[model samples]
Target: MSNIMETSDNEILFIVKSTPGNRQREPTESDPVVSTLHNRKVYKGDTTILAAEFSAKSSVIIEWKKNDFTIYKESPQYHAGQSILIINNVQHCHHKKKYSVSVTDSKGRRVSSSSKMKVRRDSGSKISSSSSSDSDE
Candidate 1:
């Protein structure tokens, strides 16, 4: 017995084949598996994106969180799954912040991945001072 699963060009394909005397169960909805989430560094006032990728047998729900608090999609910072989490005009307050992405499959199985954001102050923003004094000639 052989089975082929149809998938979109952007989706991964899985093929299963079984021989006589060897029975293989058909695929079913499974938990989403996190594929990637990497730490990112960006300069203050710049934009940064935290992307998350997953693999599952069925559709899944994606959610983003910061410091364990859910980040609503209505917020301008959220750009949905395509970008996962987009931070515009990053600030020092966001430095060392932890961001996570959770994916839940139809079966209720869920998985998560997290990454930290490192914000660096722009060199041009640094303040420098110089003083010069001359004695009476």
Candidate 2:
């Protein structure tokens, strides 16, 4: 018996000999499996938190990206993300933006999950109410 698996641009093949009372063994270092990032909705200027849970046999590196662009850890808006990513002061520019998180294990196997941000205007804000009135004039 044989089976093939794909991970991070690499393929792995497994071959098993059929025998009486023989059982398949578990893999020692399986690729990291990550959780989905659910889409979020927040008022402008609010804080947002995005998290991706993963399981791996070895330590892993976590990275975050926005709209396919890398979001550096040094960015003011970016907080820690061993598994959780925080973005503070969400603005209009963040509306509809796609955010992704990648997890890479020691073996260089990587997987990613993404979610979109929906930023909404704060209806209670005076500035938003005044802007709507002005636009109608």
Candidate 3:
């Protein structure tokens, strides 16, 4: 059998296979850029909506915060959505508060932006109250 295998008339076949190890690539995302501009202005007893937008290569989760605290969705006072945040009634309590939106990818990449709300008195008077967490504006 060995001599027959070695001879040209009889042949034996052997097959081998190899594969390179796969390398995992790190997740990447661009800095979250807020598309919503123009500070919203709403008088007392009026509803106002704030919207923000951004793009990323991977799936991302979005959130809205007021003064660094997470806002609940569809709450009586605050209505939060994937891209839009709504304040039911503009009131003194919300004036000049820092409102921010953050986008976080599944890989833990995160970016955020913030702005202050300007709540005005419904009465036609120049006297309006303003407050802020910091004196940035």
Q: Can you tell me which runs of candidate 2 are displaced by over 4 Å? A: 1-28, 73-82, 123-137
Full candidate order by TM-score, most accurate first: 2, 1, 3
lDDT of each: 0.48, 0.51, 0.45
Clashing pairs in 3: none
Q: In candidate 3, residue 58 scores what lDDT?
A: 55
Summarize candidate 2's per-residue lDDT along 36-127 as a digit string, tens digits: 77766666765555655555555556666778876532111111123555555567664458878776767888888888776777732322
* Ten contiguous residues minimizing lDDT sum, candidate 3: 1-10
TM-score for each predicted model, relative to the true structure: 0.57, 0.58, 0.55
Model 1 lowest lDDT segment of ten: 128-137
Measured by lDDT, the strongest candidate is: 2
Q: After superposition, how far is residue 95 of candidate 1 from its true place, in Å?
A: 4.8
Error of 3 at 43 (Å): 1.1
lDDT of 2 at 111: 80
Candidate 2 RMSD computed on C-alpha atoms after optimal superposition onto the true structure: 17.7
Tens digits of per-residue lDDT for model 3, 17-117: 11122212332454433344344455666545555545554555665666776653211111121255555545666545777777665566777777776
TM-score, prediction 2: 0.58
Model 3 collision count: 0
- lDDT accuracy of residue 21 in candidate 2: 17
lDDT of 1 by residue, 72-98 (tens): 321112112232455555667744577
